[model samples]
Target: MSDPDLLAKLFQGDPRSIARSITKVESGSEGAAELMKAVFPRTGNAIVIGITGAPGAGKSSLVDKLALYYKDQGEKVGIVCIDPSSPFSGGAILGDRIRMATLGMDKNVFIRSMATRGNLGGLSRATVDAVSILDAAGFDKVIVETVGVGQDEVEIVKTADVSVVVLVPGMGDDIQAIKAGIMEIGDVFVINKADREGVIRTQKELEALLGLAHRPDMWMPPIVRTVATESKGIEDLSAAITSYFDFQKAETGALKFWSDALGLENVHTEIVEDQKVRVAMLPIGESRIELLEPTSEDSPISKFLEKRGGGIHHIAVEVDDITASLAKLKSQGMRLIDEEPRIGAEGCLVAFVHPAATNGVLLELVQTND
Candidate 1:
């Protein structure tokens, strides 16, 4: 368990402890659960903003400037940068240290880079946990910047108190917002790099799209222009965000709906944790064996027993070299279930060991290919 004293300090707004606590949670350390238990009550105070857009829209620069703007207003900010995982390496490209260089040095600023890690949402489950940690640690605003406008990115917006959809001028897809379902979730739309040509055209198109979608709360999401690199229009963007918050507050029914939805999410998490514990405690042997008599003609095992008889059971083995070991096994007269190794959940390449080689024991082989 984490030291309760340290976790208390974090909830009491100690920045250093908060940073260390976030690291523990992000790394999935043992005591993270306890730390979160201590901090949960202190959360629901921070405003979570999710920034998502298509790739190459300069979302990172916008996030950087936006965080700086919040800090200038005397508000401590926390940022979660969700980087897409490389298909080959399964690692993120824009690591935390590289993307948030400017804000990383600030004591009031906390920045974390989260990889998709094959999570359904572009953001990891840990990203939600990390945001809660930051919120509980007394950051006034928490920002989550996602890499692209895919389905996963859209899911990230559902977790945020406010969602910002960013676009760039001259992308040549005026209807891209409609295609991405960006018009639905956006609390604020930012036309980043607004100094580029076709800025007015893009703005007009966005306005037309906004006109078509009538929100239940009668709130029209504003479209703001920004040259994020030059830091222009940042104040206007910030103001627009504030306006959304105010409008949400004024709409009591909408506010209640949002609250109820988040409440349901909390309940769902509790149920999942309960089920996990139950499954873990169940008494089940690590391995199982089935036997068949030769007289039982209907038994599937009887046919195999008659053919191979007492020859060999399938042998399950874990190997470090799946390809080379399988090749060597094949040369030694062993049959393989799969000609090529395939991915398995155990973080290894897996193949079936020939039943003939292992004296009637069905063998499964797992090997770490990476």
Candidate 2:
């Protein structure tokens, strides 16, 4: 990884390099943090999907099918399966090589299984870092599949852009706690094993429960029924996910996760117009979030919504010297979307790096007068 060429290979979507990067992160190698920081600018393009549910609820099966569905659409998929740790071995017993045999055959699909290894918190970050590696390596979709319906699983799922809570028919009132907790997190409700006897009953129960629960985002969680073995309802499930992704663009709830994680709160909010479209600005730290929800449907973010629904708005990094940095970048022959600095949110001078320069990620460089 110290070799510049070897490190560069991972950015080119080399599978071996990607695998080695994940291994380093999983093992907490010394260079792992630096590597992640370097790749951060290239991330935020891929869709993160979290699949979680109780054991035997067919969570993995649903993930497998949904991933396959995405692959069928010619998208590269990445899967990180969190398996229970074995006290004796301390390794993933059901490794990716063994469990996802079919997905393994596809060069475009990268699957890794991680053992809980008694470090639930560490495992969550490691799993997230692994997904970032795949995303930087050009994966279009990264799905994190975790077992059980506990707090640890909930924490891991919180890192996802969209989360799916898997369930099966006949769990009944015995799973009330799960419903209460998981229902609060799930963006999509999945009823797998739809061929079961109590399929309709489960759907009715989910609908009734959803009616009782309210989300601040106002995005209605869709119930999708699927028989994973037969790959039934996968298209419907995919559609449901895409629909939700679109619905969240106008809301600030999506950025709330990261803002809260960073222990930062929105200090001031104001509306700014760009090209006849109104966008919201919520300032944090020395940077501010330029929200993409547009007042008009003709702006760039609006077109982005029509095409890809809601995706990453942009990654803005602060720089001490914007002009000098841009000059150096130009001399280095990097493609820049904004050739000169302009006033962005909070009156910060900013410029953008073209996606061609950063692995399909839109990046903004911000500089403050201070």
lDDT of each: 0.70, 0.78
For all predicted structures, in order, the TM-scores are 0.62, 0.68
- Estimate candidate 1's RMSD in Å: 20.4
Name the lDDT value of residue 298 in candidate 2: 74
Q: Taking the tens digit of each residue's C-alpha lDDT, what string does model 1 give over 1-370?
A: 3487787788776767876787777677888788778778888999999998776687878888899999998999998877544232124434555655666566678777675544444246677888898898889999988755566667777789888988888764745644446668888999998989999988888888789866645568989999988999999999999999876765444224434554311111111121111000111155322111222354444566578764433444667888898898889888777678876433457777756676756776778555
For residue 102, give model 1's deviation from the true position in Å.
1.7
Instruction: Give the winner by lDDT.
Output: 2
lDDT per residue, candidate 2, 1-370, as tens digits?
Answer: 4646646988888878888888788889788888898778889889888888877777767777788888889999988888544221135644465555766566678877775665777888888898888888889999988865568778888888889888899876735768766888899988899999898888888888888855645467999999988899999999988887767753656457647676555555433343333345556656666555555567777787788877777788889999999998899899998899987655779899988988899888989777
Candidate 2 runs further than 4 Å off: 1-3, 84-94, 252-370
